[model samples]
Target: AQSVSQHNHHVILSEAASLELGCNYSYGGTVNLFWYVQYPGQHLQLLLKYFSGDPLVKGIKGFEAEFIKSKFSFNLRKPSVQWSDTAEYFCARPRGGNTGKLIFGQGTTLQVKP
Candidate 1:
């Protein structure tokens, strides 16, 4: 079965610090990738996604992800982050056959200090 893995389990950063969280998947076929963020006491929000086209995909709030087909990796990056960016991030992908089931990574918690 396909799965997602996040390199960092927890991250602490001060304001205006650059951030890069690694994400990799174990899949050999065509795939769609997504990054979701959940702020404190808030619902999961879609940070960014990469289905096709350009390898570099940008999303809301200065967030972006790159899809490297050769490496089976989709790493999220932000040049600078704010305290408001603190949250839990999850890397995910839909299961095969369009079952609507998603496989998510263990997740990484980012704590941004003011």
Candidate 2:
């Protein structure tokens, strides 16, 4: 079965702290990786994505993700995080043959303090 896994369920950091969230997928074939973020009281928003071009793709709010096909991993990273960055982040992939459907991993809650 294809699924996404996030190693950390919760993370705490102060302002200007570095952030890295591990995400791994269990698919042997091609894949499209995505990172979604849901701020407090906000709907999910696309953080970053990787399809086919460069392995490292950048997205909104200084966030970026790198896809390592050899390891079947797409990890999210940020050099420095702000208190406003606090949110629940999700790693997702489209279901096989159903691009409209997504399989998301158990979200990682990021609590950034001022």
Provide the RMSD of all predictions against the true structure, rounded to 1 decimal. 0.9, 1.0
Clashing pairs in 1: none
Per-residue lDDT of model 2, residues 1-114, tens digit only:
679999999999999999999999996556988999999999999999888989999999999999998888899999999999999999999877756588999999999999
The alpha-carbon deviation from the true structure for residue 53 of candidate 1, after best TM-score superposition, in angstroms, is 0.5
Q: Which ranges of candidate 2 are over 4 A from the true structure?
A: none
Candidate 1 residues 7-111, lDDT tens each? Answer: 899999999999999899997555989999999999999999888899999999999999988898999999999999999999999877767578899999999
Flag regions of model 1 displaced more than 4 Å.
none
Provide the overall lDDT of each model, using Cα atoms, as 2-decimal numbers: 0.93, 0.92
How many clashing residue pairs appear in each of the predictions shown?
0, 0
Kindly provide the TM-score of model 2 when superposed on the true structure, using C-alpha atoms: 0.96
Model 2 root-mean-square deviation: 1.0
